[model samples]
Target: MRHDHHGRTHRLELDDQSLRTWDSTVLASDPEDGLVLDRSAFYPGGGGQPPDQGVLLWGGVQTRIVGVRPRDDLWLVPDPDDPLPPVGTQVRGAVDDDRRSLLMRTHSGLHVLRGVMARDFGVPVTGGNMEPGQARLDFDLAEVPAGFKESLTEKLNAEVAADRAIQVRVLPRAQAYALGPIVKTATDLLPPDLEDIRLVDVVGLDLQADGGTHVASTKQIGRIEVAKVENKGRGFRRIRLKLVD
Candidate 1:
């Protein structure tokens, strides 16, 4: 869900993530409950990517933020069960760069994997999930052929070597629909009043409507290894993967 507190959405880390620390004011929050900033660099856990963990700083008082979620607004939950500061207070928000970096690599790896699978075998992945350093994707197919893992591993590395620039665009609904995103489910997950669709594009590779943080280029993802594969009956197969970097 999109968060619009005080009629402003969080200026997300869409274009560049070079800025690790964000100096902003609290837009809205409950003193007994949560924190909502005017702008944030934290990823609010969506599209199989997990939320970012960091800290909120103000007046030398540092509050650890273990998780961030979107309700009507991006609620910042403090760790050690601390109470939230009042609204309109100044604070510095920072994301765990190491964690975010791993997520970026893992997230981009999956997209490249999806593109390669679709291109090489013409198979659409049914579902997927991203973890700290690894991810798993499911494909609805009868059985895997011999040497499938080797072939997939080669393709994934080749894409990372391609060094493609990952682009993001907030497109109008009509323009976004023309791109034909491969949605995971029949139920639309986008916000009901969402006028613009965020399109994640791996240039010369893949394009889809997505909401997640990613590395700027495919090269940043380094390499990928197909760690495991689970054969689920009824034509379902799950493949687990890890980022080589």
Candidate 2:
């Protein structure tokens, strides 16, 4: 399977992160199996980001998509009370701009955090999770410098103000792995047989193998506030961040 195709559904979001709405044909629709589309921009959740939520409009009715089940086929889970578009039905798919845009900014902001931490503290991210406007990353830091939280907040905002460009690219497996040690995770989780790899680059900051949507630049992330830093023991420190207006 190609990296851009999820099962039979052509994943439009992979190439166009800014695309919010598009026309598609319903390929399969089952009450229990969920719906599949010939083309979709709804991002299937992966790499610490959640799947997108939106609606499919057809025949003057709206079928609300609540979640996604990524499998052999990208199954779009719709709201139980909504009507389903039958196979071969033409429909208009729309991703919730507010939710997806915020997610893009938040995901990019986390990369900024990763960049700053790696550049300054030289630590690898152990784990992380994110929502629309908030995120937290765990790092394997043996010691926290004095005023570490304040220092990190300042550095994070500085990078945001820098407006560093974010670029996405797809490369052959060997070429991607050749950029040794790009995966920021404490453990490399990429599948062995995957022929193509998708990479997200916070230009001049951080680059990693990722499969999530992101903003065009760091400035699009807005102000990042380091809300808290908690010591999780065993040389693990959790840093929480919030995006402010």
Cα-based TM-score, every candidate: 0.90, 0.99
Instruction: Report, for every candidate in turn, its global Cα lDDT versus the true structure.
Output: 0.79, 0.95
Deviation (Å) of 140 in candidate 2:
0.4
- The clash count of every prediction, one per candidate, is 0, 0
Top of the candidates by lDDT: 2
Which 10-residue span in candidate 2 carries the lowest summed lDDT? 176-185
Candidate 1 per-residue lDDT over residues 1-245, each given as its tens digit: 34212235465576555557988898776644568888888877888899889988887688788987677667877785655667788998889999998998899888898787767666667778998799998887676889988888888898899999998777777778877764533245776677777777899888877878888999999879999878977878888999876
* Highest-scoring model, TM-score: 2
The sequence of per-residue lDDT tens digits that candidate 2 reaches over residues 139-180 is: 999999899989989999999999999999999999998987
The worst-scoring run of ten residues by lDDT in candidate 1 lies at 1-10
